[model samples]
Target: MIEIKEITAEETYPLRHEVMYPNHPFEYIKLPKDQEGKHFAVVNNAKNVTVVSLFFENDNAQFRKLATLESEQGKGYASKLLDFIIAYAKTKNAKKLWCNARVNKTNYYKKFGLKETHKTYTEAGIDFIILEMDLI
Candidate 1:
């Protein structure tokens, strides 16, 4: 069995660092505004957090640092977590939901109706593109 629940920002750091920035210093995965965002995690039967994501709300909601353990990939954990986040955003009356998706993962995000925007940038040598889903 698996469960998804709200978690502290610190709880997300492990998976974020392990899966998203393994080669960089652990601090590389720490977001400056982590305290201001809502964090969540997907825990497996054994109570291990296999996936994590962070969200910030303003006029629109933006999710960041979505990561899943390498061993947990292809199992649909991230997809479920994303679906939850989208619904959560709507509950907050957000006009949109967006993310700075890694360029290589845009196709994966597109599966959930997130559209690629013209904005693009490089951070830590990885190319990223803005993807957004209209919520209103």
Candidate 2:
């Protein structure tokens, strides 16, 4: 079984470092106001954290540094985690939940009802498009 639960930012660093920022410095995975953001992870029956996502702010929750173990991808863990985060954001009275999704991954976010916004940006040689879901 996969268990999704809240965790400290520090606990998520390892997975984020390995899956999201492997070529960059360890600190590259760390975002500002990280402690203020609520972190969550999907732990498998083997007790390994296979997915990580961070949700921050109340009225406008933002997801960042979402990463899943390479070996564990495509098993629906990320989708499950996204489902949980959506419910969680609702509880926090968020009007919207947004993320900077990689160009290639926009379809994945679209599956969760997130629409692409006009905003665009680039980082580390990769382009990102803004995707957001209205909570109300």
Candidate 3:
């Protein structure tokens, strides 16, 4: 079963390292899970990974990292996470939502009304464009 829950700061330490190391290393977003950021993990039985989300509230709450485990990719887990975050942001009264969506996945964000706001940029060896969705 896949469950999404908020992770404590301590709980995210290892996961953060795992995500931002080797293949998917991202240092800018690595943060203590409990330090105002929300860490949502989609875990299944027997401790296999499904997905993870790391984001925080701001003038506009951002969907920072919506990551699906390598084994669980292309199964709509990312879509579900996006839907969940959109609904959660609505509850928080966010004015807008934004992400630096990977170029390959630009179409996905477009489906959710996120318009690309910037030209392509490279970060951590990945190509992406900034996309924003208006909450109001």
Candidate 4:
């Protein structure tokens, strides 16, 4: 079975580094969420898991460093975790959600009611588009 909850400090920060700065290792940018933000994990009975940090302020939330082991990719873990994030954000009274969606994942985010913001851009050598959803 899989579960979702706040990301702990132990492994998430490093994993976010790997996700955002995979090529070079350097300084870690500290954020308030690092020690107090929410996270969701999908784990099996054997204890293998995938975790992601949740970021938010006011009526907005961003899903970042959504890392899953290569072995677990294509298993719908991201979507499941995203489902949890949206629900939690709603409970927190969030009115919007933003994601720097990889160009390839735009369609996926669109399925969740996100619309392209005419903000196509590239970052970290990955083609991306900014997507936003009106959650309220």
TM-score of each: 0.94, 0.94, 0.76, 0.80
Better of 1 and 2 by TM-score: 1
Better of 1 and 4 by TM-score: 1
Model 4, global lDDT: 0.72
Give the true-structure RMSD of model 2.
1.3
Model 4 residue 128 CA deviation in Å: 2.1
Best by TM-score: 1
Note the residue pairs that clash in candidate 3. 20-25
lDDT of 2 by residue, 1-136 (tens): 8789888888888898998779999999887788888888888985545555556564799988888889888888888899999998888889999999999999999999999999999999999999999998
Model 3, 1-136: lDDT tens digits are: 7766665544544544554444654455464444666666656673425334545567587766566566667877667767878888878888888887889989988998899886678887888899998888
Q: Pick the lDDT winner.
A: 1
Error of 2 at 48 (Å): 4.1
Worst 10 residues of 3 by lDDT: 46-55
Candidate 2 overall Cα lDDT vs. reference? 0.86
CA deviation > 4 Å runs, candidate 4: 17-21, 26-33, 46-48
Q: Rate the local accuracy (lDDT) of all candidates.
A: 0.86, 0.86, 0.68, 0.72
When summed lDDT is taken over every stretch of 10 residues in candidate 2, the lowest stretch is: 46-55
- List runs of model 1 lying over 4 Å from the truth: none
